[model samples]
Target: MAKELDLIEEFRDLSLVCEVTPRSVKLGMLKLTNSFLEKVKECQKRDRKLSEKLVLIDEGKEDDF
Candidate 1:
């Protein structure tokens, strides 16, 4: 009976640890995803600026002619 009780307690502890691990992993993944999204937004802003500059350059060349 004592051995059975010990086994049960161990199983419960293991279950709790398992539950906590997935939650931690999910939080880490969420943070990583957010960082990636921020980088994407930065790249989009840079691309927009580059496109605007290109347009200005093209307009200046037309005026030169």
Candidate 2:
């Protein structure tokens, strides 16, 4: 029937839209993940430097006593 054909067309269009929507969302999530990872790396580097400084300070204090 013509009505069945119309319903099928509508379903196909909706399916295509649903598939494309997730791909765009996935791309956006990838970008956000990369940005977050970069920030984490920078924080880790700063933390490592601070830890090294603390160790040096502790060593100097032990020498004084």
Candidate 3:
């Protein structure tokens, strides 16, 4: 839960790659980087179905409020 990305931190890293997620993805984490994480993050921000469940949970919070 605490691992979720905040909007400010999310947008701050508009160019995050897969390696950047080692802390989150863990051992067998599929390597995503550059446009991959960028697009995925974008989708995670805008599109529901395309985003990961964790990202979805983060995006769903009203912390910005």
Candidate 4:
């Protein structure tokens, strides 16, 4: 929730800095940015979980060669 609000504020500031002319275009860009950020975060979380699982497996199993 707070993260989302921070992102929204950042987008607004970016748009202001870039001098984006139209409100609709600014909004469209913001939505795309938000969606991309969410996907990246989700991927990072999944990767972390997979890494932890791999570590656990390595610790629990013994090589039989």
Candidate 5:
């Protein structure tokens, strides 16, 4: 909307208080960062689980050696 764009243009140069609910920048950043961290941790857990399965498979193959 034009109103939204106007607001963005208005605040494109102001840096006043930094801890008000109206200043959603920090809250949005925190939410996004937390979401990213959760995804990274989930990916790492999946990777480690896959690696463990691969190691188990490799051990089985070695037992057949």
Candidate 6:
């Protein structure tokens, strides 16, 4: 799961490497940027949930899941 999150982060960084010029290019870059950021947000949310579950498990609260 950590690895998956890392890959998503890398993709988010990659999406930031565009060079916008014309209007169309700018629009496309905006689309790509938004897409990558949404993906990052989703991954981060999942990671947070997993970490919270791990903490619960450590405290012997596995029934909460």
Q: How many pairs of residues collide in model 4?
A: 0
lDDT of 2: 0.55
Q: List clashing residue pairs in candidate 4.
A: none
Candidate 6, residues 20-41, lDDT tens digits: the string is 3434222124442488888987
In order, the Cα lDDT scores of the candidates are 0.55, 0.55, 0.52, 0.62, 0.56, 0.63
Q: What is the overall TM-score of model 3 with all chains considered together?
A: 0.23
Model 1 C-alpha lDDT per residue in residues 1-65, reported as the tens digit of each score: 67755665665655432222422321121222488889988887789766677677788853331
Model 2 bad stretches (over 4 Å): 1-33, 48-65
Candidate 1 residue runs with Cα over 4 Å from true position: 1-33, 48-65
RMSD of each: 12.1, 11.9, 19.2, 12.0, 10.3, 15.7
The candidate that wins on lDDT is 6
Residue 52, candidate 4: Cα error in Å is 66
**Stronger candidate by TM-score (3 vs 6):** 6
TM-score of model number 5: 0.24
lDDT of candidate 5 over 29-64, digit per residue (tens): 222247888888788777976667767778885342
**Candidate 3 local lDDT, 10-50, one digit each (tens):** 64455433232635532233355598878877776876554
Give the per-residue lDDT of model 4 (tens digit) for 35-63: 88889888877797666776777888633
Cα error of candidate 4 at position 20, Å: 17
Task: Evaluate model 3: give its lDDT.
Answer: 0.52
- Assess every candidate by TM-score: 0.24, 0.25, 0.23, 0.26, 0.24, 0.26
What is the Cα-based lDDT of residue 54 in candidate 3?
A: 53
Worst lDDT run of 10 residues, candidate 6, spans: 23-32
